[model samples]
Target: MKNYFKFKVLPYLLYLLINFLYFTNKKVFHHPKLKDDEAFIFVAWHGDLVSQPLNYFNKRPNGTVKTMISQSKDGEIITKVYSLFGIGAIRGSSSKGATKALISTIKEIKSGSDVAISPDGPRGPRHSFAGGVISIAQKSGAKIVILSSKPTKYWQFNSWDRFVLPKPFGRVDFYMSEPLDVTNLEFEEARDFVRNKMLLNIVS
Candidate 1:
């Protein structure tokens, strides 16, 4: 029932609020660290995902981008939202059957897809680290880039991750750090490195 509300009911109603505020306030900043003809992974703090995507995709150089998401009702709404922007979302996340999710992510990347992830999402202690992304990058040999956004004006949801919803036409500044190549380390070491990199990028 709760999932039903989050995915089906609330999002549509929130659309008016999002559209009104986002369209009305529209300043954005972007940074990129991409390579030509190379596949990569993008990691962003869960709290910054909403506005970060709005800022990053405009400069995606690559025409098609794919994202990984949870399979809950909220995930359904998110998938719909991504579709509206012509982005492809793969349904899976860490908290629920993480191994399976990682496998799916690996397959997608091996197929030459540029993927995005929330390393501390699908359920969270509000930005705490998780191992899935590190494992994915280590196995697939994809360079991971961490990015974060701070909205000049927005609402912060009281959820586990304090999700940010930017007001229409608001100014959102995105800070993107250089990519961290994970092809050199073992599983555990790579995981810790990626987690630390994400934390540093987000907390700045």
Candidate 2:
């Protein structure tokens, strides 16, 4: 029964839940004007994921968004949920098989697809930005933008990231940071800059 639910039930429920929330929520985008073909790497806290995919993609019609998902059982369910929304995934956690995932994601960006990374994800010391994203932006020559949000109502999961699921018809401020060219900043400096940008835009 557990296997049946894992393989047959979870993905459908998650897809229905995400779609329902996406349609019900009132979202406000405070983001820079984006170019359809411009490759970008988005930074998001692992917790703020529930409505992000639909909202972000709705604003950009031409590019695809890919993420690095782990190889675990849970990752499989999440990947299926993502595919339902037409989003793609590079299999592997940011920390475990990071080298391969990082390389793959950089290639996707250079090919004009947008990618999103939760700096503290797949397992976490939640909300703390990590260096992998800065490295990807540097190598891929893509702009890095943090996806910060404030939601009027939501449920927080007991998981490490305290993953947030925005409630139905809730108002969400989907404020994305202005694009930063971290390709040239010193490694640590770049990391700090992105982290600070994330901090400034997120509110309680």
Candidate 3:
């Protein structure tokens, strides 16, 4: 029983503490250029996920957002953390069963929920965007919004995506760029545009 608590419950408690510091201590600036009723796709760099949830759900505290995770042990841990924060996770990735994950994400958006995604997640080369996120934007008729966060102090994990943990009581800044529309573009063109736009938002 002690081992069970140590291995399972402890990690979740730590995750909750991290989120507490992130949401309570940060000064978030939201520039919502999009309409409230409009559904949208969200793309963020993996490092920016340290405070992603705080930015997406500010207006509607109970709003639903979906994200993708790989079907691995780490993914399982992340899924639990997201669930605790009221986030929905679809377990798949670009290298794995991406089609099913994309289908789930699209369905969520079509159902009037915003879909938050990390285009360069689940073992990314870091900051390189993929095509699937844009495809969802085109199919769902939703504008794509890029979200990012930069904390004044944090830990960067030495992983493929450089997972971040904002230090306790540190100030974090969230940048939500103006939404991108892909209403009347070809698949390839829309994908390229969204990818480039996200990359620009990350650095700018």
Report the lDDT tens digits of candidate 2 across residue range 3-119: 889967888898997788767888788878876768899878877876677657757765589988888888888888888888899987766888899899999998888998888
TM-score of each: 0.83, 0.93, 0.86
Q: Please report the TM-score between candidate 3 and the true structure.
A: 0.86
Best model per TM-score = 2
User: Against the true structure, candidate 1 has what lDDT?
Assistant: 0.74
Better of 1 and 2 by TM-score: 2
lDDT of each: 0.74, 0.81, 0.77
Write candidate 3's Cα lDDT for 16-114 as tens digits: 786678766656665566677777888888766757777777655667687888887767777877877788888898888899988998898888888
For model 1, residues 54-158, the per-residue Cα lDDT tens digits are 655656745566888898877888887766666788788876756777887788888877788987787887777777787788789888978787767778888
The lDDT, on a scale of 0 to 1, for candidate 2 is 0.81
Error of 1 at 82 (Å): 1.4
Best by lDDT: 2
- The CA root-mean-square deviation of candidate 2, after full C-alpha superposition on the true structure, stands at 1.6
Model 1: runs farther than 4 Å from truth?
1-20, 168-170, 201-204
